[model samples]
Target: MLPISKPDLDAETVYTTCTATARPKSVRPQLQQLTVDLNDAVARYDTAAAGEGLHTLGDLQHQPDGKPDKQPGIKKPKPKAGGLNTHLEAAYTNRLVPEKSPGHGFYEQLMAKAPDGRCPLCSQGVADTLDHQLPKVVYPLLAVAPVNLVPACRDCNFHKGDQAPAAAADQTLHPYYDHNVHDYTWLVARIIEPPKPSITFHVEPPPDMPPTLAARVRLHFTTLKIARLYNPQAGPAVRTLSLNLRRWKLPSSQVPQHLLELAEDAAVENPNCWQAALYTALASNAWYTQGGYEKPWR
Candidate 1:
């Protein structure tokens, strides 16, 4: 996961802004009353996230094991219900998400924070939507909380829909708070030979890393199906590398060194990126560097 800076805007400001233009004259007072709850929920979320205790938060207890979309015949809460969860969810879907809404600028502000418009969760897909870290349907109080929203691609958001961690180890890495995970090289890849000349990615935290942190990294990799997302893309990359190697007319003896240089350059940009992992694995593999580039990237 790519680490990003936490939003400077606070929950109260966003909550008040979103609720300021609530439709239906009667619901205005009720939406206004929820401001304090939003503030308290944001505080709890910040504290629990920092302590790795978000799974223990009261709101999580109400989250169902599976999402409505995934579960057959499960219906989502109606917007007209006007209940607490519905109201808050609408605050997001109606007030914050719509293009003409007063709080729509904040939505753009959050999306703009994505590094080069790439989702931090996968660092691959375009960041076009805001995903709730704690799931707004379950933790309605944080529906408009700035810190609870993460910029993500639609695929990442769909893959992570309504997932509530059962424990600290199960929690996916938070970009804002888990910056330390990116401080070292934990993501690595292995070169597969023969039948299929492909590489697979996985997490390999350093020895000095704490066990909990290591578990979190593994879970993050698994939950997002990172290997599945990256392996197919590696095939085209290998084909490109082979074409480039031949185009440059580099000798077999120089292939490994060239691969190492590429790995170093990729690492300079992102230590844990799939490109860095792929090049590092290829540089160490004997067959891949010594004439293995001739193999058709099946």
Candidate 2:
């Protein structure tokens, strides 16, 4: 995934202040009461996992005894029909999808100045979904923390559900936090024809890189299931995003002229090394042959 800069948080602060001011003193206690109830509910749902292993609110709700009950988790709060309460509803709705929600137009305006008018993860052609770096489920206080919020494709979001605390030596690369991960490139692609219509890609480590980096790469690949595209649920997206597509298309006839030019140029500059390393690498894939151009080579 491409890296993303953190979004501006000024708007969130403004919203919070406005929300507090708009609430009448008479209703403040009621709001606090509701907040307390919500926190209690959250605590109950959260406590079920204390040494109990794999317990979920759903499991509690659907126990074999067939008695549905309210677990400790907080119930959704009811907003008052009008006035200040409606403003509170608007505040939350604004935060739901900061980019598109009109109530949070300030956030959208700030995001518009981002490099691609989208979150890095979203712009990377992955599913667009808001992700909380520190899971909101566990760290309720960070639920609206601007720095903690990130744009993520649906796949990444689903995979990361509720799991925070990055693994030791994880190379999965946080789009916002990790800055030194761009050196390695793990491209995956499959050939469709010729000597062997098979996938061929390389996981290249930077020259003299440390073992931790290699470990991180391995962890990322396995966690993300980057290489196991054959799995029924794992095919399309990751493969498309990670692999160089041109190499999978095949024969010179299918290759683009620009790519052929690039191959020739690289070969000319570093003939032996380019042919053996670069050309051989591209020649091994069908998609690479099909494109014959490399925007990333530079």
Q: Give lDDT tens digits, candidate 1, residues 1-298.
A: 7789999886788898887776666777877876776667678888888888788786533322222222235676455534555666778998888899988999999998999999999888899999999887667777888998999989888888787777888788888788888777998999889886778888999998888889988888877787888887888998999989988889999999999899889888788999999999998999988888877878
Off by over 4 Å in 1: 59-73, 80-82
What CA RMSD would you report for each candidate? 3.2, 11.5
Following a full C-alpha superposition, what root-mean-square deviation does model 1 have from the true structure? 3.2
Our tally of clashes for model 1 stands at: 0
What lDDT is reached at residue 64 by model 1?
22
The CA lDDT of each predicted structure is 0.82, 0.42
Residue 173 lDDT in model 2? 44
